[model samples]
Target: MNRQQKGWQQLFLFSLLPLFLAIFGASGWLWWNWAISPAQLNAAKPQQIQIPPGTATQQIGTKLEQAGLIRSKIAWDLLARYISSQKSNGGFQAGTYELSANQPLNEIAQTIWDGKVIQVSFTIPEGWSLRQMADYFQKEKGWFSSQDFIDAASQIDRKKYPWLPADIPFLEGFLFPETYQVTKERITPQAVVQLMLERFEKTALPVYQKSQNQELNQPKFTLKQWVTLASIVEKEAVVQKERPRIAGVFVSRLLKGMKLESDPTVEYAFGIRQTPDKPLTFAQVRKPSPYNTYATPGLPPTPIAAPALESLKAVLNPESTEYLFFVARYDGTHVFSRTLPEHEAAVVKIRRERQR
Candidate 1:
């Protein structure tokens, strides 16, 4: 071992140390950025990325990378494999996801792995019928078939939902109207119906049950009858403040054993909607359907449409009034009258005004 040879060996080792240090620094930086850093630090908006059914993990990683939601596909693959190894049921769920570029690679991977897909929302307006809701779902494009929804609503599972009236013909007014949020996995007709019914049980049914014993100075109605009357009010009353007034008139008529003569009932009987241009014709009102209040003295067989909470409440607590008849003014209000002659005069005046 000469001094010269030892010096040469030391120099060689020192040169190798710099090369090793450089490699180590580069690897650490890549790993840190790939695993923990976001693609965009200040990204404000999220991008919608859809992972179709049966999409492979690698494919999903590629999608996230292309959508600029993650920094690297390789990092995603490694993290996904590690996550899959930890869980017994290990796979990414298929659906649309709202992912932001500001999210770290691991957080985004966990979201997809946990099946936290984006929720889609749909709204059913007040007084909408089952057919209308079915049509809406069909028009929404990817939710469900209209016939499927109709079939689901028609087939009532009493065992599952014992609160429903046994003899109620169909679930016309029971499906509570509201905005519902659902994941792609729950887009089936049965799921949607179940949600609405459950919402009714939670929101609407409780209202009826709470008022079951209270005497509102009105006619005592069964659950079916209450819903039926509420549906009528929902359709007839365009003005929010007129709900109780309109309900009171109907209550007065019902108590006196007189026909309700509700125009909505006539429309419901014939399954036709009347417009200002074409009101209910005499012949249509004369049609002998059990639903026609014009021909029938009592309430209809079933609810004509779904009633809102306000309308249902209006029925439960109707305003005490002497008015027995009312007519729409084509505006969002009505003219109430105590006698048929007064109602006729109001109708004549409204007609003349329309003509002018």
Candidate 2:
């Protein structure tokens, strides 16, 4: 080759070097922005986003981008494909996710790929009734309606839960009260009720079963009767230490064939909750309802509320006391009395204290 041709070739190569460098720099920048850097480094909170079932990787990327969680959909598509190629069953899981814009693209992709869906938590306090649970779920975002929970709880499948009492009209105290966690996909009323029932079978039912042979000397109360008494104790005893004492009072009343006269029973009958400022009225107590303990003998047809583990335990082993009467002090403590006159005097004293 001639010297001039060789020199021209070298110049041509030299000129193209700038273009190669520019291309390399641009590629590096794109990789950093799309795959490495966060969309918003200062993002404060995470946003809950739902990934519908069977959503494609490309569609998921688009959603992430739209939700301001990812810098680029194209980058997500490439990353997801790479992950799928590397792993046998690598795919984004479907369900609700809590994603933050501050998270890196790879981290977010891995979260979805690993099926780490956001777990929603709901808590049912001890002594809460089925209606209260329904109302609570209604208040929670994205949960089923109050009526849905009530209806689902009402339909008890004996085959699935053989531990449930056959004569139960509806799942009242049987739906164990505790904090439960479930994914967004399993947030239906039926699912929640099943979880509660299962928890009851696992926790509360075992306690009752274990105590069956142990409480030989105690009153032979049926499972439903025990739960009914426990629920009453749960509602009556606000102070934790007083649970056994309250339960003893109810057991004594039941033994003597006397009316329970529990204020909570009257509230349950009328579907009302009374506070210290507003006590149960004479008319309300006299209101003719099967659940009105003041007017009815023995336990109501069903439990008025869900009993806690302690309350259930209290019923199993009540304190050996002769006290059959009690009045709430409005300060979570109760004044126990052996006679009706003492109870009336305690009630009068409580009323005077509240007035002062």
Cα lDDT tens digits, model 1, 107-161, are: 7888888878988899999989888999999987557789999999998889988
Tell me the whole-model lDDT of each prediction, alpha carbons only.
Answer: 0.88, 0.88
Provide the TM-score for each candidate, comma-separated. Answer: 0.79, 0.80
lDDT of 1: 0.88
Clashing residue pairs, candidate 1?
Answer: none
Residue-wise C-alpha lDDT for candidate 2, range 158-253, written one tens digit per residue: 999887788998999999999988998898999999999999999999889989868366787789998998999999999999998988888889
What is candidate 1's TM-score against the reference?
Answer: 0.79
